[model samples]
Target: MVNIILAIVLLIILPYIGLWKLFEKAGRPGWEGVIPFYNIYGMLKLSGRPTWWLVMILVPGLNILVMIGITVDFVKSYGKFKLVDHIAAVALAFIFLPKWGFDKDTKYTGPSASPEFREKYKIALKKTPAREWADAIIFAVIAATLIRTLFIEAYVIPSASMESSLLIGDYLFVSKVNYGARLPMTPVAFPFAHHTMPLIGTKAYWDGIELPYYRLPGLSDVKKGDVVVFNYPMDADSPLYRPVDKRENYIKRCQGTPGDTLSVVDAQVFINGKAAITPLNGEMKYTVQSDGSEINPQLINDLHLSDLTPVNNTSFKMNATVLSVKALKGYSNIKSISPDITPKGHADPLNTVYPELFPNYKITPNFPDFKWNVDNYGPIIVPKRGWTVKLDSLTFPVYGRAIEIYEGNKVQVVGKDILINGQKADSYTFKLNYYFMMGDNRHNSEDSRFWGFVPEDHIVGKALFIWMSIDDNASFLSKIRWSRLFNIIR
Candidate 1:
């Protein structure tokens, strides 16, 4: 994970210091580094390099190669070259320049890199020989692991499903404290790679602790209205594929805590008849996409809504619409209007949210499982061993699982398709237990809506803080949003 830290430091932390050195090293004013592309030219000439090098450096592959060489030469000239100097060349640009120029009190009196500077730079890194790759890999792995597990983990908001609550370009810090944290399920999380899976799952009360999140401690429990980041309930997405800070860990409000009966009527939220305080967590206004497509901006404006609000373009259902309902579309209603005022003026009445109320029903579990929806599945009273279940009481055509009561890890399968313990059972109880987790962006998310609840076995950790975030369009330098800099995830 040291590499991860280095990457951050070099990319973020070092620049401030390096920019100063860049000015001094160039023999120009210290503020030169703080300027735009001028620093590139300044550093190039300081190292006895050419202005053309800056243009080539802007090129993808060529720039990377040039930077590696320049870094070592730059630092050695500044007098910091040592065992770690090669890494400075390979990994540090911002650090080397500032430390050499501004910090070291050097001044840029030249137009470009001097021939002597380039020669010395090559010699410095060349002396280290084969250890370059090894050092870089070792440190990066250590940093990635530590950061991925205990500290804040970064993620991106993907779909517009959570339009009003999050934007496609938004990066977030998922606090792990809201839910009890889960130790690494997989023993060794290989740096930059997924090698193995962990053994013990989280406690029934500790699900969603899987990936990095808000839980700094293992004592907290996730409650309704709490925003959360969990493994995608569906398999269509992968966090790794997302951008470094933009990885897809959906940010959605917790509509239903475990065992909460979530429903919608006409559009307003009525929990056991009491209205739920309207939340802006699942709401947003419209904006244009980069592709020029019109859609909800998925922004969390910290604003409220009023009656007669209208929105469309995605799917939504009022999980808790205790407020007023105006224009309605598939599953979504307006939770916000022009600027402020929530549909519901009162705070969310936090209370126990139970599962859908249903009478006793029968089921025939098909082996290997069959296609089924959580809404229409047969309501099977959890079949305990002593309670006799009958074959005639089964409802068929649902997903099937072979009835296998095992001693430890081995479960026995009776038939490809059969009833459980004599009666039809929908879900099988585990030696541990299972959990149901769904994204608040109900329709747009690929969550438990498809694959089913997260078994206690798959939880990771709670998200904590947003370290960094930038959009695809923002400048590498212009994108840091200070308002989100250290905001807490409630």
Candidate 2:
């Protein structure tokens, strides 16, 4: 609250106070400088800019650029034309605006945007090649930053979590406007970098200033089956403890939206008691049994089988799509193929059973009986905004992390009682909607099944289409996956 008050004083009040003094010098009523929209109108009149620029100032993202232009013109009208003067006027306006307004040497020369003023001082305003290049670079950086933040951004698939559907080398254009562009929570950051700088290996953003989470109006809400990109929620408690927007990015399919009860039974997902549509190219684990003969390597390559491990000369475990498993059954040497699903009430033998599959298992007393695995887990409810749930041993393990870490609550579990923010509580109301995400490569993904729900503020955007796809292991001649190019993501 103190920081917010200081920000208003420095950014809002002080600048307007300086503008009031400047208005008196320019033969306008000082009170006009303090009014909201009228102050912008006054600046436009003083700078001799067209009234249409005021309309652009009212736009969301474009308003930033318009304001910068108006500020520079207003400074130039006072005969301050140096690059440093313009920088100070925009960046340290509260300090410099008052400094210039009080200086007796400073005077209103002429309207900088007027034709007569430009003609009289044409030689002084002429730019050298270096200045022209600098201006062009500055404009390009600002424009590109706004477009990347508010419209669409290019992203490269970094892992095979969504394999067969989105390959490791697929480049996609994620649309920010689809589910509304989230404003930056950590606003002071180095340009063109997310959390860390490349090569230098240092933090790229300053965490001293943080804005509240907010999103602009969007075309539609997040829907089930959309390929969505979101910040990794566990990063909040990771060693670095990065801010929400600066967390690592992950892409997964939205299997369950807010207000839906999601579960996985026998490796198949169900939402609200209805079977969810599976990804057409989604992969799952299977155990293949064969005669005492070597399975053909060519067959393995043809089916895009992965994680192939020979249990013996006769049995092998591998990941394959449904179609691949069907095709393998037709082979003469292959005896039978069975899905490698962990049955209900059984813990996953391969992974650490405590917290990886059942999040907050170590902290909640009732978690030991969950016995859930990636293949057979949860009729858990996805949290929706304003929805309330009773707090108890059973539901605490399921929703504790979201309430405590994600929603910024103080939670303590004492024997059989729940204490929230120093008060005894029996229930919690979700402050934000959450979605359940899973990778299409079911056996390989560390997703919501492991970490719990993804808060709405963590959502980045909806994946639109793949613009490029490259196979790193392919020969140079066949490196590009041409068929996947420009394909819309389902």
Candidate 3:
């Protein structure tokens, strides 16, 4: 809040203070310059622009361009027509405005935007080709930046976490408007780069300036079964302490919306007390037993089976989609295929080896007897905006990081008591909603079962469709996956 106030003072108030002096020099009342919207009205009148431009300045994305145009015209009215002076007037307004306002040599010449002034100084105002190119480039950058930030952005599937639902090589257009375009929390950033600059491998943004979380009104709230892209929650900790918007993006299917109690039993997700809809093309690890005959390599390729390992001549392990499993069952040599589910009482080998990978492992009073694995884990309630939860050793591990780090509350455990914001609290109400996200590649995904819930502010957009698909391992002639292109994401 203090930062916001300081930004307003520096960016707005200080420039208006200089405008007060400039207005006095133009034979207008000095007070008119500092009166917010009225000051803009006064500037339009002085610069001979239509009063309707004030409406344009009030708009969100368009307001940026309108203000720049107005500033340039206002500077030209003061007989400062050089491109450098216009640049300084708009970019370094806090310093340049006051400098020009107090300079005795800087005097009001004429309304630069008016027809009469342009007609009188037509030759002097005529733009050169280089100047025209510079103007065009500047306009393009500002316009493109606004579109990318508020409308839609292009993203590529870098990993197979989304699997057959969204392939590894698919190029997608994620619509920011689907879940409301989130206003940039870290406002000052490189125009095109996300978190880091390419080639240089350095930070692309200055995190010194930040804004509070806000989103424009959107088509609808995030729903269960939606393919969503969001900033990785774990990036908020340790070595990569990126700002919320700048964290690495990961796409997954939203299995549980806010306030839904989600759990996975024997690799099948259950919401509340009912079975949830599974992804049609989602893959699962399975153990396959075959008649003592070698499986055809062509059959393996055709089924898109992955991670195939021979346990013996007749036994094999592989990851396959439900459709693939059914297709493989048609073969005479295949004996049986069973889902490789971990029993309820046991933890997954990976989770057991790296306990810290599980979200709940960090709690002080650990659940020594609660051995939950990826395939048989969680009846945990997802956090809702206003829902309150009791703070105890058992529940702390599930919700502590959210309360302490995500919500910006100082939490400490003193013996058996939990202290929130230096006060003893038995419960805490969530300020933001959270969703449980999981990958379609069930056994291979490191998701909510590992990192915990994704905060609402971390959500980026919905995966709209695939615009292109490339099969990197294919021959040059078969490089493009034609069937996958333009497929709408389910």
TM-score top scorer? 2
- Model 3 lDDT-worst window of ten: 361-370
lDDT of each: 0.42, 0.88, 0.87
Off by over 4 Å in 2: 1-11, 98-106, 350-355, 365-368
Instruction: Kindly provide the TM-score of model 3 when superposed on the true structure, using C-alpha atoms.
Output: 0.92
- Evaluation by TM-score, superior candidate among 1 and 3: 3
Question: Candidate 3 overall Cα lDDT vs. reference?
Answer: 0.87
Question: Where in model 1 is the C-alpha error above 4 Å?
Answer: 1-140, 176-181, 194-217, 233-251, 267-278, 284-443, 465-469, 473-485
Candidate 3: segments with Cα more than 4 A from true spot: 28-36, 54-60, 85-95, 98-105, 350-357, 362-369
323-385: candidate 3 lDDT, tens digit per residue: 999999999999899999988868586454357444555454643335788788888899999
Model 2 lDDT tens row, 140-254: 9878888888889999999878977888899999999999889888877888999899999899898776666889889999999999999999889859899999999899999
Cα TM-score per model: 0.41, 0.93, 0.92
Provide the RMSD of all predictions against the true structure, rounded to 1 decimal. Answer: 19.0, 2.2, 2.4
